[model samples]
Target: MDSIRLKIDSRADQVALAGRCIHALSKVVVGERAAFEIELAACEVINNVIEHAYECREGNDILIEWIHRDGELQIDVHDWGRAVPADVLFSPLPDIDHGDVTNLPEGGFGIGLLNALSDRVEYRTDEDEGRNTLSLFRRFDAAGISR
Candidate 1:
């Protein structure tokens, strides 16, 4: 199948719309678990871009694309905002404490979840062009092994 691509504003609503498109495609091929994983990862990745890189700025366009090849589904997120520091982009993931409500942090888990849910996660920045692209992937067969 041909890859699907979208160019959306760097706003929460538009980002969510982009994510919904991925969710719809995932649900049809993968099971509910994998579908949700893909959907959540998509949202988290964009949220990080919005919060950190774009600084919640509006009007900027974010590029999102979905491609399925060789039993793998790939999602690419591109942004023209300020380049994120490599340390922040590749930091170690934090642990989640779901059982303890009081100990739960308000944020800081998005990156970890993005890395965990997707089979592979990569970030590349075009220094001269001042652009960044995040690539996420999910591998599945008939049973849909997204996790």
Candidate 2:
């Protein structure tokens, strides 16, 4: 098992960090396709924190950790931000109305994608501490590849 921790400042930095992690893990985990899926999933979660958690506030820190063990991948993302609303947390994707391009919102897609890509997704928030934690998990096969 291996673990790495990083503190990211900006959205671009977060994406870069995700890319780096993916590159490092890919060496150990086989199958480029599965690796790319995991990397994309991580990017969506990290970007969510960068855009919504801090609301573009400067100096807000996001902590990202990756854990690999027993043919499984675990990613933890932590941030200090306003507590996410319970409704928003569990809300289903909105149905497309007439497929109008302009009517569609740019946001909410990330959360939807995260839920779809990862095998497991969990969230924890402490209002008093203003902490939000997102945990993602994907189980891999003996070949170090996910299904």
Candidate 3:
């Protein structure tokens, strides 16, 4: 599989650069629709890492990789700042009271959105090593299916 890799310091300022690259690459293989989906998911994952993974610390780093081959696209996001417990990061998002916009939650949609938009979503973490890996996959060929 041919892949493109990007390494960024875990800072908010660098996210835009990563997003542009991911969008451009996805656009080439799956066109704008798939690419936009990828962008949304990628942004959520990156933001979560920056805000939570390195929480209460500074100078962490993360790497994003795009693997494309045989009509499949896999995104692997890795970080070494802090390991998120599977129960927290992999669980489904809690239902919010949307009827009352005044009481709406400020967060809690990252994993669910990612799962809803990708064919597969998997997360692994090792708290002792302060490492986490999130893998998202999708098929973009003629048989491609929407999330």
Candidate 4:
């Protein structure tokens, strides 16, 4: 078990860093299913930061950390951007009418996907400092079953 840290800038770099993390973690994960689940969850989270945190600004930086401990993988994403409202952040999934493609929104599904994929999701923010921290954790046993 090890810890990996990355400083990501730019949307492209965020995706690249996520891919690298997934590749590295795959080597230690017990099964393909767990690895893929974590990778997909991370992808959605980082993409949300790129799209909403800094509003696609080019210079903003995101700190990503992955820790493997006690047969669990934990991810922490830190950003210095406008703080998202707690109410909206924890709100239930939006009601999407399948036929309304014209009015369909581009975002809001990342958090939902992350929640479904990860065993645990936590968030913290400091409005004055404009910093947001999101953490996700998933546990895998030696048998490759999620605990």
Q: What TM-score fits each model?
A: 0.87, 0.81, 0.85, 0.79
Clashing pairs in 1: none
Off by over 4 Å in 3: 93-97, 126-130, 143-147
lDDT (tens digit, per residue) of candidate 3 on 51-129: 8888735577789999987878888899986667676756566588779998786778887787778888889876777
Candidate 1 residue-pair clash tally: 0
lDDT of candidate 4 over 31-77, digit per residue (tens): 67667777777777777777777788878888888888877888888
- RMSD, every candidate, angstroms: 2.2, 2.6, 2.4, 2.9
Rate residue 38 of model 4 by lDDT: 78
Model 4 residue 33 CA deviation in Å: 1.6
Q: Which regions of candidate 2 fall more than 4 Å away from where they truly are?
A: 90-105, 126-129
Cα error, residue 45 of model 4, in Å, equals 1.3
Find the 10 residues in a row with the least total lDDT in model 1: 86-95
Segments of candidate 4 deviating more than 4 angstroms: 91-107, 126-130
lDDT of 4 at 68: 81
Give the range of the ten consecutive residues with the poorest summed lDDT in model 4. 85-94
